[model samples]
Target: MSDKKFELSRRNALIGLGTVGLASAGAGVGTSAYFSDEESFEDNTLTAGELDLFVDYWTGANSEAIDGGTTGSGQNDGGVSAQYVLNDVKPGDSGKLVFCPKIVDNPAWLWAGSSGFTQYENDLTEPEAEVDDTGGDPGAGNGELADNIQVTVAYCEPSDDLEGSDPSGPEDFETVRELNNPEDYTLTDLLLELQYGYLLDGYVEEGGEWVPTDDGAYPASPDSDTQTGPCICIEWNVPTTVGNVIQSDSVEFDLGFYAEQERHNENPTSPYATGTTDDLYPPFDSNRALGMSIQGSGGSGSAEAEIHNATSGNTAFPFGNANDDSDNFPADQDVDFTATLDVDSNTASLEVLGSQAGGTDVTASDTDVTDGQGDGNALGSDTEWQNGGIPQTVDVAISARSLNSDTTTVKNLTLNGTSVSPDQLAASAGPEQTYLVLQGIDSSAGNTIEIDGTLNIEGDASGWSGIDGLVINWR
Candidate 1:
């Protein structure tokens, strides 16, 4: 045999010799590096790490207000507020709230004639007045202003640790989130999971007739027909743990209105018009627009604590958009919304980066002999090893086949596997298919691999021993 001795570093020797009988060497290894044999090594090592969950803003529901001042032709600027009781949130955790508004109806007028016939009016002026002023019956005129409907959402999470006693008091109001400007906000990833609907409501008349009323109640006639409002539903994501709670967020909706008279100018002599008079009647057409707002808050609550169980594998919760019946709003009038939490830890995927020779095979090893077989062929097999311990080191021969097409340019290589170190790996420019030397084996008393530096593999066209016994772990 050639007198040339393989220069094995202290790290590699310890790692190679440490494979005495450990059975936890399969936790971080990948299937690609499995042994030539079909049998697999069963590993049972547990690792400790932190996880993060994300939440986003979304729209809820919308309803129309038919009350006196809340109807068509009238300006409605009313809102409702309620307190949400979180059962398990802890101090320091953060949360957010979002709100959205939708137009449930358009502004219009309905007229009842003396002949007991109903007529629909598009103008803000009376038909008889239009005829008297123009010498011929004219169509209704447009109203002074369009629909002026506005909606706002405000949230707070106060703490008793502060200078106040009442959590809901103004002094205690923390102002966690707000949705006053829908034009400036963007929706988060969680909010894009569901669909939303738009709606409009207004008044309509049957016929064009006018009757003098003894009482001067602005036309004095009741509407011939009343239009109902539409409904919308929203969906979003939420979290069940302390870390995720800080990422909880929300969305708000806002419906906009435009002046009907402005739009009517395009149709100066619309079919609905009777003559060329400015006397328009009630029931003018008001254009509706939909608006949206997204916001978030940061605070702790009882709800966070109840959901995050250290011992339990599950840590996710869900919430529905149904309103409390005691709130006095009709069930149909409430917005329909849904919230979900993504707590499955397995959903997270890992990636490793490094370069390997085409003919080289990465092997797996066990530190404890009692936990693993003696032969070095335990690539896919399980071996006993400590958590975060070094299980194996790779030794390969650099050759022409392993080099890139240029043969001189060092190619950035990537090794994909779990618990891999150097997290990233690379190879330098040299010859083709030559035995390249790779050293360093994590032999810390524990089975975990402590990788801190890079390993170089170099050779000529003749090629060298690609790699000998390599070790890895899988979970």
Candidate 2:
């Protein structure tokens, strides 16, 4: 995994002699091809021409062209730049590019070759560590670039229906039929497949032997009609959804396009493939290196923490003493409301001394007690509302633990006026069904809470029991 560069120029691509090497084989990008032909003795005196391949470039839009000239021992047909070079890429930076492999003198079977892939993490920084989730060893070549740059390789077909195809009208074959298809691969995956003679090559093992897969492959580019063949297009992107995990990272590799005479030839896999391509395809493994990145600078921001004391003021009630209280502040309640309720075990310190066995004595009193319902009529048997006039229905809640028995009863215990739910009373167990329960009671007026219950314990007490917590939400 040494640092390598796959820089290929038109000048170098035209020299096809020793180009059969792979990226790992030392050279950058070059095509590897060999064709077979038979002599036709029909014409004694004959004119012959070597089969050749020329590649032209279009920036996905078919708006501009870069003639790579003849990629076989021919000089440049110079217009602008003949090859693509991506630099200073950023998130959301994406588009497609087209490559037209123009065959001359003869139609040729072609195979796309890519090899010598390398990825570098570059100088890791704090910004990168903040978002990077690769969990790989630092300072290693396990960068995130290749995995973040998604690549969609598909054969283009001319159509007037694709968006922005009017420039070439019906003859524009640049519509990416399946650019964002579910089977799209990242750059690393795509390159790995191409190097192994698998992707879009039309040749795969069938019936226990290597054979041609007629579909999912580009037909041979004909020598007779240059404009007829479909263009091989690639749609690349560091998707907008990608984040800073790829920051300060980079990758390099060689994109090799190969070709051979189509006559009497069927299986044209990559030239650099060794042993068999079957072991690497059908289902790719998970050993992948891909991610997105961003360089340079921008603005910044920061954050800190603070503290508060709920000892006094609006949040100071049981709120300061009891964080579990559901009571609200004076301002939070109705302006006409002027009443207060105090019910805290440790704070109130109320104790009722009664007989150890069967007895009907469990009477307790608090500052304010409505019939646990919203009907706020204040006085008839209990105290009067400190404010005045007849009030509205008052909603009440209680959290208490009383020592008693299972058959305990509290008269007029209507939790809310229509309190018919068994959930209104919950218990903590004693020695043999003896209990510490919570129940509501009503006063002479239908709206006062009287805590009067009769205990019916028939056995010894003292057991492990206590209600953990309770919360009843009104839906």
Candidate 3:
């Protein structure tokens, strides 16, 4: 309530890339002030007020000697750097560490009706204090540091994780606190606070159907007399295509476990402004973004597939996240070609359905076509051809590896035992980088292809890549 923020920092905590670091633990206390003014009769005597809130944590691994004791498993050096080390990390990687924060025997108090009333009761509830309720209102009244301690996490650059530096500096802290709670109190709230707080970026494709379901993630809150044990498990994932531009990019942070006296409610109008101003301190905020970063491997080799639209190995396919419905060709040239290949009978059929400027639509079938896994021998779908092209069917075998690649070549395309459009085959194969985007495999079909004007392909649905529902159906 005092609007005061207590920040703790760690310097050079090394969490290596692609590895999880041990849990870090540390603690500190917030202070309170008492003022007594004598405006009474001659024989009036007074004593000083008392208030002390202390908090400390024990890392899952080691216990150290801080406030004197024999040097145990580790050194209780104090501050964040003494707790744990977070090293190099990348996207899609996660790490965890557990620790507990407990309130030792400490003194706490709250002001009654007015500021400085000095009529102290047992704890916060005993007094049942009142707030102004006008322009600014003090939050709900609860006694002890249990209700007053405000904890928040801030993001910064690794270079800024310094000693004695103001971790709250605007330049150093990210404005948006990623750790947030949902609008309502659902099972997700418990799951987020207890298990997935480390997921700074919410649920991605990585978390397959990880919807929130209550299974005892968050325990009950601690009362004034008891100490609550909450674990802070920090995690990071390295992306598959991490390269030069992304290399060495680090995200530094400061987890400020702040505590302020509820006395602010007493001064309702002035300095004792009740409650914390930091948005990250709100209740049920496990969804708050964890300030983190993933370093790049600095390796190279074209992390993307090449889309060839024409010969000369140039004229790359102009495919984008959206469909280019505007680019419609008018007249049809000698562009009508079609072929149907029957793998079982080793027979083929060729027909010119229509005319087109480019290669005609082609359909390929292989009795042995499968997901390249155990599910074998199914009907193959037809290849989609763009730009006023007629459909052509071919009998051949296609593998999953070739489908996932950026570029694939259908060499020596033949019709009636003669080469048809060899150059066009290369172009089609190249642009079909994610050509393997399929839905569930049909009983008779090897793989259900998702393409424009096809049942498998949803014209309006969108996928993560901005492409239209082109999900890779990996068996």
Candidate 4:
């Protein structure tokens, strides 16, 4: 029936702004402690034992170096720190932290939780763009690092040296124990799991989810005159296979500790419900693009491409992987693309297929073909792509440079599965960025677009021919 907290005040190990530094906090209200003697009975009523909690912390990185905590001296300062922080972390880098709790009075039920989970993409990198969740886009998307970093937490006994510093790994500790069969959760998933506070050993995995145990979290031991208290050691690392997608990302959160009176508390539940990433990455994602497969059938030239979105430029229109490619076609790739430009009828055709990530066959409901690739979507779970991201149609420009001798020509332009000829399209010098507007397209079978044109290269003409560009953008 009381409303006061006998819990240990929280010391934040915050994640900083820019590069996502591990900033641990330990300073709290400076109220001194009051302990009771081993007395059997008091005046008229039985005296309840005191149960105030305190904390001591330690951190380690790749070199197993101490980042300043209760490290050197044999005394526990009760989690005092100017800034127990670690910066300049990299991939394949693994580290551990021990947040030891002390009752300073009596043993009690302990709980652990996290809050203020924030993340930001900050800057965009190509490797990251390739594997990001469906909804994230540079600057306006979730961060990648936290989701890529995997963590494992366990209960442990401090090292024999009491130095609390491990040069090799947690194995140097006296004993490294687990809470049931704990899974190696990514930092992102772990944050969600700890939102409302986990009852520590008091929580168990039932069926498939983690829930509060019947008897509640186990009563963890507190510090004594001769030994340190049971420790909650968290070890985390970025896997080598995760690639460079998480570069230049940042994440922040607060690791908190709580305690309740075990003498009466049953089915303990935490009130801490703060689990939102400042800017974290979605676990699964994809991009808005012109999905296609190119196949050639009888011709002298090729127009092969599956890269590029709705807004690609004319230069990359027919082949490049999006107009943004620095080295287009045969330059960035090692293989040759093949598509036929009919030599007899002088006609060339290309058919491309479209279907959003996890989209089905539009075989019948082919009404309004989605106009543009909307803001990058969280494709899988969301199960839908919104329209109006980039323009649905592009201005297929055709400009050319010709030497003396003969001439190479392009005519009878067909776009978006329709035949629309302008200026008779019949050109001996290749039109200069011609503007042609085609209205209403058939979006059946997932918006399949077919482009057909006539090509006439006369007298070994001293000229070149190819699609100019797509003229849209990169999602």
Best by lDDT: 4
Deviation in Å, model 3, residue 465 alpha carbon: 19
User: Model 4 off-target regions past 4 Å?
Assistant: 1-48, 63-84, 126-141, 160-175, 180-184, 202-229, 273-475
Q: Rank the candidates by TM-score, best first.
A: 4, 2, 3, 1
Error of 2 at 454 (Å): 76
* Candidate 1 lDDT by residue in tens digits, 1-475: 0111111111100100000010000011223322333465545344432111111112122111111111011112221122122222222322222221112222212111010011112222343233223221112111100001112224333333665442222233333334232211112211110111111112122342222222211121122122121111111122222121111111121222111221124311111211113222111111111000000010111001011111111111111111211211111111111111111211111111121211111111222333232222221112222233323432211111222122221122222223322232232322122212223333324233222222232332221111110111121
Lowest lDDT block of 10, candidate 2: 298-307
lDDT of each candidate versus the true structure: 0.19, 0.33, 0.21, 0.37
**lDDT digits (tens) for residues 1-475 of candidate 3:** 1112112121111112111112212233445445556853354445333222222222221122011211111211223232333333232333322222222222112110101100011222211233211111112111111111122332212122445353221222222222332112211112112221232221111232322223212221233234232323222223344322222222212232222222332211112212123342121221110001000000010011111111112111111111332222111122222323233332222232222333233222222221221112211111122222212321121111111122222233333344432212211111121121111223222322221111111111110111111111111
Tens digit per residue, CA lDDT, model 2, 387-465: 3322333322222122222321112223323433232333232101111222222222234322221112111122101
**TM-scores for all predictions:** 0.14, 0.39, 0.22, 0.41
Regions of candidate 1 where Cα sits further than 4 Å from its true position:
1-227, 237-475
TM-score: model 4 vs. ground truth: 0.41
Better of 2 and 4 by lDDT: 4
